[model samples]
Structure formats: structure tokens, C-alpha cells
Target: MLAAHFDAPGGPDNLYIKEVDRPVPKEGEVLVQVHASALNRADLLQTRGYYPPPPGASQIIGLEAAGKVVALGPGADGRWKIGDRVMALLTGGGNAQFVAVPATQLMPIPPGMTDTDAAAIPEVWLTSYQLLHFVGKVRKGETVLIHAGASGVGTAAIQLCRLAGVLPMVTAGSAEKLEFTKKLGAASGFNYKDEDFGTKCLEATKNVGADVILDCVGATHWQKNLQCLNTDGRWVVYGLMGSGEIHGDFLTLLLRKRGSLLASTLRSRSHEYKEELVKAFTEQVLPYFSPGGSIQLRPIVDSVFPFDQIADAHRRMEANKNMGKIVLQIPV
Candidate 1:
């Protein structure tokens, strides 16, 4: 098998493909012959030595994959058989031709959904579902202010919010991106590059503020996020696209509002937790992607790159030029 490889990485220039031994399924695992995978910011961080695969996880990069099951490990024979098309939520290692994934982490590809689309679903959709439903405990008619509104997770969040009857407000850097988010059902989109998104969000909601905030931008967004938070609101921080460090009376402001400050990461969570999330998403949300669904739920794919052009894929994502998940087609 061949997979993306990097040594002492600092930029996309350092990435290349290298032959590697394919992994075999362990107990309750399935061997998937990957057809496609997608890029996440975690891949870039790992390349630059900022993030590494979790302990005992595959050292290879990639967090999600969509492919066919080739073999099943012991204790996995009940529900799956060879040649089942599935999308896997991986801790790491989805860039290669094959990967071994826990059977519990695999979701059957929604009917008529392409591999590229399925590959885009696991990381962003599942993460968005986790944030909006589990972490934030958002209710119908509440407002959620989402940072990076045109991102993969952002796009997913928008549709999920609408389906749940929650209004979603988003912040993007460009007019085009904002429009794209609106088409996906964002109630209001703010151009954060020029305007104050927090103020815009308040105005959009009649100065009532947001019941939840899904923030990926860290330090630069901290104060504004706090200001826009509704009383007793849940602020869920997942990524640090901005600098991680912060300075200010954050605790004081949060206490004054009686708000809850929570942080979450899907990748590093326990296997059992991910399984539970997958099961819930599979039961409740996955069907929305199928044709003739009552809602407009779907995965947003920005672009698809060939596996050999892995470096270019990284460049596109690093430049923040993508509005949704960027996919890679694994070579046959």
C-alpha cells in the first residue's frame, strides 16, 4: 500500500507518497480498501509537528475514509460482510489504499451517495452533530453563532441547525462564502474580515444574543464570542485556527453571563464515545442524505484531488481557500 508521507514537515512541499505495509484487522475491526479520503486541519498540524496521532493509533495521516470492506476481524462477522461499502470515522490513517478500522466506527454509505461524499461526512458531519446536539444541548428556535461559516464543519452545522429548527448565524471572510452559507440555510452571514460579527449576530437576533457558539477560531474570537453568548449559553471551542493563548477577563465576563465554557475534540475521544455518536448520527441524521429526504441535509465537498497530488491538496486547505471538505481519491 502507498500513503502520504512527510519528514520534518513545515509546509505542503514536504509531503510525498511512499509505499507502506497495509494494516490488518484486529478484533472487532474491519479491513477497508479505501476508495477515497478527505483532508482535515488535523492533517496539516500533524505534518508541521503540532499534532500527532493518538497513542496506539496509526501513525499515518487522515481521519476519515470511505471504501469497501474487504475482511472482518474476529467478533465482527454479525453485521458486516466482505464488499460492504462503508464510511469510517478514524482516529488516524485513512490516506492509504487500505486501513483497519473498528467495525463500530464504520457507517454504511447512504444509498446512492458517492465515495467522495461519504468520505466528507464522517469528520465534519459527526463533529458538527456532536457539537450542536450533545455539547451545546441546543433547542429548536435557539440561535447558534458559528465561526468559519463556510468550512466543512460549518456547512454541516448550518444544515443540521436548520433541520433541528435552530437558527444558525455564520461568519465568513468573503461575500461569496457568505452567500454560499446562506444557500445552505444560514439565517444570517457576517463578513468578519470587515465587520464586527458579534454585533451583527446580536442585531440579527434582536439583541437577544446566541444560545450557543461553535468556535474554531480561538484567541481572536474569545471576547466577541463571550459578548454574543446568550445568558446561560453554551460556548463550545473545538479548534484554534487563531492563536490558542488568550488574555482578558474571560472568567469574569463568563461568570457575569452565567455562561458555560466548554471545549471539545472528536478525534481524541474514546472509542466507545465515538461509537455512540456514530450510532446516533446513523439512526437520526444519516437518512437525510439519501434522495427524497424531507430535508436538505447533505455533505459539502469543496474539491477532490488525486492521491498523488497530496501536496497540492494541503496547499489548498492551508490557504483557507476551501469552503467544504477537500477529498483525495485513492489509487486503485
Candidate 2:
């Protein structure tokens, strides 16, 4: 099997294709014949040596993939069988022609859903789903603010908010991106470059502030995020794209507002945690992809690059120019 390998981590150019031995399914794993894999910020960090794979996970770079089950492990359950088309969430190793995933983490692709598009659904949607429901605890009729509204997770968050009857305010870099998010159900979209999102969001809510804030941009929006949150609101920080520095007095703010501060990274979570997310997503969330639910995945593919163009994909992501998910098609 050919897989992307990084001799040293730094940039997209560091990724190189090489033949590696095909992995066999372990007692509790399933070997999948991968059709497509989607990109994520975590993959960028992994390439740059900022993040490492979990113990016993593939060092190969990929977090989510859609594929067909080629073989089941010795102890694999009967719910999944050979040739069953499924999508999976994983810690790594999705960039190859074949990757092994725990059977427990697999979900059957909805009927009539394209495998290529199914590839785009798992990671971003699941992450945004967990952020909104599990962490943010968004409530109906509440105002929720999401940053990076045009990105994969952002788009997913927008749709999820709509399904829950919550009003979503989104922030992105451009008008076109804002328009894109609106189509996905954002109630209000703010161009983060031109205006203060906190002020705009406050005005959108008539100064009441947001009930929950799903933020991927950390430090840069830290103070503003707190200011924008309503009393007792929860601010969930999932990523820090701007700067990791802290400047103000958080202790004073925490005590004064009685607000809750929570932060986490998806990759660092235990497998049990990830599996639970997968199950919750499958049961409570996956039905939205069926038909009537507004939480359908649009897959907003910016471009599909050949497997060898991994570096170019990384460059595109680094430029922050992509409007949606970027996919790498594994050569047959």
C-alpha cells in the first residue's frame, strides 16, 4: 500500500508517498478499502510535528475516511460484514488505500449517499456536533455564535444549530463565505476582518449576548468571547488559530460573571470517548442526513486533489483560502 509519509514535520512539502506494508485487522479492528479521505487542521498540525498519533494508531496522516469493509477481524461484530460501505472516524492513518478502523467506530453510509461525500461527513460534522450538543449544550431559541463559519466544522455547526431551533450567528473572512454560511442556515454572518464580532453579535441579539459560543479561534477572541457570552453562558474553545497567549485577568472575569470556561482538543480524547461520540452521532445525529433534517452535509468541496498532491492541499489549507472541505482521492 502507498501512504503519505513525512520524514520530518514542518510543511506540506514534507509529505511524501511511499509503499508501506498493508495492515491486517486485529481482533477488534476492521480493514477498510478507503475511497476518499478529508483534510482537517489536525492533519496540518500532525505534518508540522505539533501533534502525534495516539499509541497503537497509524502514524499516517488522516482522521476520517469513507470506504468499504474488505475484511472483518476475528472478534468483529455481525452488525458489520465484508463489503458493507461505511464511514469511520479515527485518530490517524486515513490517507492510504487501505486503513484499519475499530469496528465499533464504523457507521453505515446512508442509502443513496455517495462514498466520496460520505468521506467528508464524519470528522467535521461529528466534531461540530459534539461541540454544539455535548459541550455547548445549546438550547432551542438560544443564540449561538460560531467562528470560521465557512470551514467544514463551521458549516456543520450552522446546520446543526438550525435543526436544534437555535439561532446561529457566524463569523468568517469574506462576504462570499458569509453568503455560503447563510445558505447553510446561519441567521447572521459577520465578516470578522471588518467588524468586531462581539459587538455585531451583541447587536444581532439586541445586546442580550450569546447563550453559547463555539469558538475555534482562541486567544485572539478570548476576551471578546467572554464579553459576548450571556450570563452563565458557556464558552467552548476547540482551537487557537490566532495566538495562544493570555493577557487579561481571567480569575476576576470568572468570579465576576460566574461563567463557565471549557476547552478540549478532539484528538487527545480517549478511544472510549471517541467511540461514544461516534455512537451518539450515529443515533441522535446521523438521521439528519436522511432527508428532512436541515442538518444535511453539503460537503462543500473546494477541490479534489490527487493523492500525490497532498502538499498542494496543505498549502491551500495553510493559505486559509478554501471555502469548504478539501478531499484527497486515493488512486484505485
Tens digits of per-residue lDDT, candidate 1, 194-229, equal 999888888888888999999999899988888789
Rate residue 4 of model 2 by lDDT: 85
Write candidate 2's Cα lDDT for 1-332 as tens digits.
99889999799888888999988989889999998898999999999998888788899999988989999888986869888999989889999989998887888898788777888888898898889888888889898899999998998888888878899899999999999899888999989889898888889988888888888898888777877788888888899898778888976876666778888778778778888989988998778788765456455677788889989998999999887788889886
Candidate 2 displacement at residue 51 in angstroms: 0.8
lDDT per model vs. reference: 0.93, 0.86
**Cα-based TM-score, every candidate:** 0.99, 0.96
The candidate that achieves the highest lDDT relative to the unseen native structure: 1
Candidate 1 wrong stretches, greater than 4 Å? none
